[model samples]
Target: MAYARRLWEGYRELLASEEAYDPFLLLEAVEEWPVFVRALRRAASKNPAEALRLAKEVWREEVPLRVLGVRLPATKEAFLAQVGLA
Candidate 1:
């Protein structure tokens, strides 16, 4: 545990030294959000059911919720609304 903690601290220091990278981008949710948005947008026109499925899958996952510190349904709905699919 100590070794892992030290490594994490070192990583944080390195990340802090770099101004271009937002550390939050390391989170799965933040990193994948844009891609998901684009995918959902494209899917919405061609396959609404598939887009809905993807949204539900993302909603059920814990990573985005943990990173965003938000709960289900509301968070999922907001994202869908942002893309104009809901």
Candidate 2:
């Protein structure tokens, strides 16, 4: 799980160079959003305040988008539920 988190972090770093790309579009392109959701869930369970801050950072509008260009997935609510915050 730690490794997965590190991998997600690396992916986020890569996104820094993809400023022309929509964050959601870029995230789905690489299929790292779900990994991020899972990691955020875990992080939320351990730290509520920090998790909330991170959530706001990642989901500024909290809008749901198609996952992998197919399915609309509500990852923020799902993560909140997983962390007992919903």
Candidate 3:
């Protein structure tokens, strides 16, 4: 999707911010998150509606959600590719 080259790196940079978040929150965010949900939807069934549900569920409203300054289709894996993580 051609997100900015830095978006992937910036996503990785989030690892450094681990200390800022509550560990429980991070765990819940990951397990019950829309991100993972969409990922599962794409992997297991590929249902568009289920995928959309996951996207909305995981959407972080309290925290400003950004698209890595890249395009929406630009996922973490794709972003990593830009930085050679792939």
- Report RMSD (Å) for each prediction in the order shown: 12.0, 5.3, 12.2
Candidate 1's displacement at residue 83, Å, is: 3.1
lDDT of 2 by residue, 1-86 (tens): 35435644564555455356566756554575566666767776787677776655544433422322423236767645754457
- Pick the lDDT winner: 2
Each model's TM-score?
A: 0.49, 0.49, 0.27
Superposed model 3: Cα runs more than 4 Å off: 1-38, 41-45, 60-86
- Model 2 clash pairs are none
Give the C-alpha miss distance for residue 28 in model 2, angstroms. Answer: 6.5
What is the Cα-based TM-score of model 3? 0.27
| lDDT scores in order | 0.52, 0.55, 0.37
lDDT of 2: 0.55
lDDT of 1 by residue, 9-30 (tens): 4434433464554546556434
For 7-77, candidate 3 gives per-residue lDDT tens digits of: 32334445446457555644544443344333444433434454333334323321333322223334654
Model 3, residue pairs in steric clash: 3-70, 34-58
